[model samples]
Target chain A: MSPQQPDANPSEKLSRYEPEVREAYARYRETGDVDAVQIVIIAMVREHLPKPSDAPITDEQKLVEDLGYDSLAVAEVVFAIEDTFGLRIETSEIMQISTVGSLKEFIAKKLGPKNE
Target chain B: MSEARVMPTDKKGRRRVVISGAGFITPIGNDWAGVASSLREGRHGFERVEFFGNPNVPVKVAGTVKDFVVESMNWRDWKWPARYEIARETLRGLAPHGVYAICAIDQAAEHAGLARGALANDDATGLYCASAGSAMMLHGHLGQMDRTRGERGNPMGVVSSISGTLNFNLAAHYKITGSVCGFVSACASGSHALGYACDDIRLGRLNRAVVVAGEELNAETLLPFAAMRALSPQSDPNVASRPFDTARDGFVGAGGAVALILEDAETAAARGARALAEIAGWGQAADGHSVAMSHPEGRGLANAMKRALSDAGADAGEIDYINAHGTSTPVGDRAEALAIKTVFDTNKKQPRISSTKALTGHPLSLAGAMETAFCVLAMNEGFIPGNPHLVNTDPVCEGLDLPRETLNERPRLVLNNSSGFGGSNVCHVLRAVG
Candidate 1:
């Protein structure tokens, strides 16, 4: 969190979403592997996920058909992910994207060569 | 010989427009009944501003709304200051004036018994309002942009900063589809908006419109007026705004929004809605004679009043009350006095005159709407708002009946005056209706 955040308490964590997003970045960042970050990726997708779906949030869960995120909410989630991980995600990547595991692998590949 | 000239657009079904509801937030009162009762008793709304405490800032007093705090936007919890972060995170921009405008419109909608099911299917329910400027939000946004050299700051905040966003926000919120406009005519902005809304309804274009005169007091807006020597010198809020009095200095830069519902009389009748007052006539003119000052002879001011009276087809003598644009400045009060003299002096019964600014302070663009609302209150409640601070009228203000005490006269015709810088003058003629 920025030190100068006017409203938020300094000691408080940004959100449960923050640690989930950061852990995913570190997983692929350290191991040079995408499979290890699958749990982290699932946690990130569940931030606004409705209850009743707690049994499973598989890669095939479907972004809109199952999660109910409209285009705008999807853009916001993508932006938050990009800002948290400090990577520029392109609209082409966003539009062609489907399935959660594919997104996690795509981010890992984009972050490759820059890390170890 | 000059032949009688008829204006076009007369063929359109000229619907009669009337005020069905009014809502206001002011120093004296937040609702019409409370504000109107305060006005009848000749109470002042001026108070020391609480928000801005910069000592070097001029203009010590303001008619600030008592308890309207800018809340933080947390959609779920709705808690303030904390939700502020959530608000900034969610929307590209936000506006305090927009909030005030919505609050006033809510009051008006609820008052007219049209909030819930009334406007559900109405497509023609549009609105027009005046926004002086959302200075605080704009200035803060600009400062951040400058600090980051335009690279990081939220450029979206610019929408909240300008004077036009209120129109869009209001229309979208109310689901209005007819037309949404924000008029900027300096201090006369409110009157111009009201007058134009009345025109649209009268011209058979819109069925109902909410006209909001919204302004929020902030350092960005106040410093400019203070620099112009427009604010009164009297530090004490109690006696600072002495409109039309001999000892008057200048206006107090205050803040508030007043919203009124203008509806076609036939539609209002069909709906069985109570009509507060009939918007009989509207007149607007620019005093090209001066830019920052009104014509000393009040030619433009007189012209607007004469045109309004003519438009209403009411003789000068028929005017029972005059809500003067007496802004407490020496020049403004004198110019308005001369204009009133020229317009109504010849009548065997000159209208009773008083400046409600004595109570609410000069609410900038909000002045016209609030004063016009006060006129409706005066007509309905059968009480003339008195000049509470009128200890001595200026010599130039003589020959007019400045009501020192609140009179019990039910006015048939009320002319409300509002003038602005760059030579703008607007008069709205409100007539009593059962």
Candidate 2:
């Protein structure tokens, strides 16, 4: 049997339609390109980063510590994501998002297949 | 002349209030020296700048503030060796005017020899400010809600864009323990703030007060005046604003911030602070007239000036100079002319009348504080700022002694008159101090 990937196992996460689903998810499903979703998400993240830097923002950078995003900046970034991607990310969902990579993966999974 | 003017202070003894420190960010200049030079040279601060890249806006000329720059939420200029990089978190709640307000207050406090952070937790020091809000932030906030169909909005939108934005930000940043208030009466808001601050000090409610007035100069805040047909369409920077002039069409828009420290005279003396000018007295009256138009006779303005003189225990003849609230608007200037005629003209003593608005365009909410601060500067610097552009005087202003050139003479007693939309009028009497 093939080795199981970390993201391959999904036990507790946001359902495809928990509150209201995003229209962008439907477009993502049509192409199933996570890279495209990550690119757009990263751009939005950069725009809302509280402390701008010349260094490149990596997917592994922690949102709160590395980006210097306090609660207010986090909310701004979340609002920007919801507006840009047509997603209604819940307050409970934000606590679980620690790193930029995790956020992108979680958002990408919402647009991925139902059965692995 | 109808009823004898009586001093109201005899009943409850009043404390004296004086202006100890002043700071400003004006289009004419940042400091007294710079502004005095501009006044003496008859220089105007008007500039033709594109607003929002829109070519259809009728008004183009404005008294744009100079040497002020903010990058990455950092205040970089306006004074040498004074740079402040506001954290983005705090900056989130501040509008453009709030930025200028903070800087002006800092400069004022520093000029007064008050140590940095000295006002924190100081209950005896209060704060009063006048601002209409940040139009650019308001526009952005409202546009976001509209675009999202109310799905998303800026968290700080309400506080950052509302009328009391300055009071909120300033009080918090300074950690003010005393009364924190905002005055809103259109262009007269600043005057109202100063008047009330003086009252607070005189009543012993507070030992000192920091009064600030600021405005945002952007297409959002300024272009709206164009819709009312209240803005001058003159494109030339040289003659765009001609207060009390027959050729004047409308007022030109300007923006900046001014702040002054109004403290108890005895308290200022004890603290070894030099007094710039004493806030002799102040008054206010309503026109009971149109919302957008002043009384044709300037009845409320005349009453305000009279009350201010009475409050100061002085007569019209006692005033050495009069800083007219002449915005150069055809109707407004004429009304003011009539008001001056009713007051000083009736007394047969025309103090060298002038509207520095001829040099610095109408700064709206910042007008009262700016003009009053100019009065303080004139008192200290020994010069009367000229109207400069009053060449072809309006017929109604013929009786008024509008000086066309700056006079190198100190004014002992100065009266400042300010009127706003909704017929709000406020006047203050300032006296030079040793």
Candidate 3:
């Protein structure tokens, strides 16, 4: 699968180290699979959340209201993504993202279509 | 220097300002008793620290704070007021200096017996602080932005890491409704805060004010001085910060916070608050000279001292002791000694003098606040601090009476002088009050 390919349900619920997310991260680590980028992004977001919660984070969850990501925290997560994927995210690009799903989609666009 | 003294106007109906409470977190100690003991015994607070994990760093000695928690809001073990259980949300907006500020203010408020939240929404109360923010935090935040090309950073970075961080976080924490401001004249910032706070009270602009000055200890803050060759290279902590000795090289950098509560004398009396000292008068002047060096003859400092004396309607002879801004630098100490002689000797008065910086090191912008607070302690404790480690005084200090030991004498009038980078000078005159 290409890095730009969205999950079956882009708004699907996610949590830290959940089975499928962890599985994707392991696959990404082992094979450099671009398809696991979304899961990797979700895991990074969960790690940056100020407060831990049992409620699974969804793509629809607002970064500010639901995940408690202030502007700085948002910057932190974006920087983390850039570090992880060797990508450069712009400030304007960050502003276009509001919810978890939007962030994943934004990263998907930044990563571009898979290498043919 | 002017030979004619400017007499103060009639003060029959003028409001009077008094120092009701003061607190500090210095290298010596947190409380007056402990600090006094250290000063009297000539005990210095310098310690060698690993500088920025760099083996080639030239300076290693610093006067670090003792008996205080680092990177934590909990000061319960430090015996601070119970009101210091600061919420984590508020802590998020504060830098290390801001934290020290609030902690010092907590002690001040409790010492004044101010009811919890008494200043909430009170427009008559003011908050004034002298701070240059947290260099460590600023460096980290800016580094993140630099590495990411400004795409990512901490939301609280600007407010928590700049010079005005104190005014922002402190005013919000205390709910100050009056003038919330930060003074920025470098080392003279602390004295400027106190002097202006006194003005507000004396002029009836404010009935009460909390004044603070704080600095942070970190490689980002201290190492820059090493680059400037402004830090002492002496490895022995005891002799590193010799303020007036001819052999003195440079100041030993230090960090901490000091706070004082100024109140209308009548209001303090009504509230049954004890006055530590009466802030008689204050004066400020500029050198218009170098950006980082004092005037060769300390002319600006002399003018400041003269103005302060004139503002108080007192003669130079009336001053029993002087707390000199002697930071042990080669040029700076000589300049200050010359300034002292120009003011007092011209008036033919030989007041006892000493620089407590020999004990606490130079706390940068907060030096004035910390040293003035020391003056208050000396006045109340009936002793004058010695110029410790002054083995060989410079020739410019020829006529000055720099005591070699703490004097067991009570001073009726005390003067504290501070000079900052850019040659900004501020002086305060305090009178012992019952």
Candidate 4:
């Protein structure tokens, strides 16, 4: 059996969502770009990405439980995320997408090619 | 936290708003006795200062409240923390029952022997306030915001800096949950606040209202006036504000707060409250010209005076005194004189005019209410207060009957004029109650 490669540090392993998220947030702030929806979803996940000092994070890492965000901070982040992606995350959906990976999947389903 | 108690009623059925008590925090003195003594002695409180830039600016001398101690009061003791400090200081020695606005609301309510929360649900009670720098405290909070922490600037900046919020906060604190608003017409702010409160009561919006006016000391506010060369630079600091003299350079910066409890004559009588003076009438107008300069003809100001007299149901000849808005600026003094000439020329007899700003540096928003307090005192005491530092009157002001010295004579009616930037003008007519 091939030797198992050590799992990359969570902070070192750039999520597929990182660059797209930063680019999307930058465009939204500068030009109110409507084309940055996919990028904003990626940014939202990156915002929850753990630092290298912290334990490795996963799609299953709960936003409040793992990231230690208060309701107010979470609400603020959600507000920013909504403004960026032009989508309304219902209160129920907010509860379900507590983990970074789950949120990404949820955003993908909401922003499917047909829904643009 | 419970509901405010209602005042007991007597069978007499008449209710009146009276000057049951009075207070003053002025440049000449902090208490009523001291202020009165200073006035009687012909004391002018103007002095020079270097606090603002352009020390060489010719405007020297102002009427500054002497020996003010900003540390005497705690900052957070009142609902509107900053203004409460100023208001409490203004009410330092006054009796508790007199109705007042701004910092004195609670004190005034308590002094009036009304139970706490007595005014809370009273729709017939309201509040009116006026000032320019009431919201100045927010600047400090904004400065404290940390950008590194991703902090947005304080969201409370605009609300705290708004000029009208001073009285609104006072009303809210006292549970005087009646009709509330503030007027902002530059220097005319105080007079307008009182005038508007009187209107609200007369129009039946409320049975009584508290009219309060105050100006706070702040660097941002002082810088603007200094930039305009409107402040005094007297070296002595105590002698910088001189109002009507030929050598007068400009006004000194001073802050003051005053409150008036206004009630209908019938109501005051029914309540057996001591009637201080009847608020006869008020007039307001605009210069319709430069925001910072008055019309040389004084036509708009003259009209306001005339309207106030008419509203008071008194002819111009019947007015015995005129409290002028003489800021000691060359143009302002002259424009006011011209306006006086226009108004009095049409009357059978011209009233004697004097400026309280001679004794109290221009308090801006508080000037009107402070002057109003002076008028109330003048009518009640039967005295025409002197123009303290005036030596040689301007040639343009020659024909006017200016008070050379304080005179102990009762006047039937007094007309107080306050004009401000943006052409805003207000005139109040007060008559002594029997």
lDDT (0 to 1) per candidate: 0.74, 0.81, 0.82, 0.64
lDDT of 3 by residue, B78-175 (tens): 23335466654456677777767887888888878788897679899999899977787788789877965665565677878899999998898899
Mark the 10 consecutive residues where model 3 chain A has the least summed lDDT: A1-10
State the weakest 10-residue window (summed lDDT) of model 4 chain B: B91-100
Give a tens-digit lDDT track for model 2, residues A5-102: 22222212223222223333344434655665676677667756676666787989998999887777788777656544445777898899999999
B317-402: candidate 2 lDDT, tens digit per residue: 88999999999998999999999888885547778899999999999999999999999988988999888887798888776788
Q: By TM-score, is 3 or 4 better?
A: 3
The list of candidate 1 runs beyond 4 A from truth reads A1-116, B1-13, B50-52, B71-93, B153-155
Alpha-carbon lDDT of model 3: 0.82
Q: In terms of TM-score, which candidate is strongest? A: 2
Backbone collisions counted per model = 0, 0, 1, 33
Across all models, the iRMS values in order are: 8.4, 1.8, 3.8, 17.3
Find the candidate with the highest DockQ and give its number.
2
- DockQ, per model, reads 0.13, 0.35, 0.19, 0.02
**TM-score per model for chain B alone?**
0.91, 0.94, 0.94, 0.83
Please report, as a residue range, the 10-residue window in candidate 3 chain B with the lowest summed lDDT.
B1-10
Which has the higher lDDT value, candidate number 3 or candidate number 4?
A: 3
Where model 4 places Cα greater than 4 Å from the true spot, the runs are A1-116, B1-21, B46-103, B106-117, B134-136, B145-150, B154-159, B236-239, B346-348
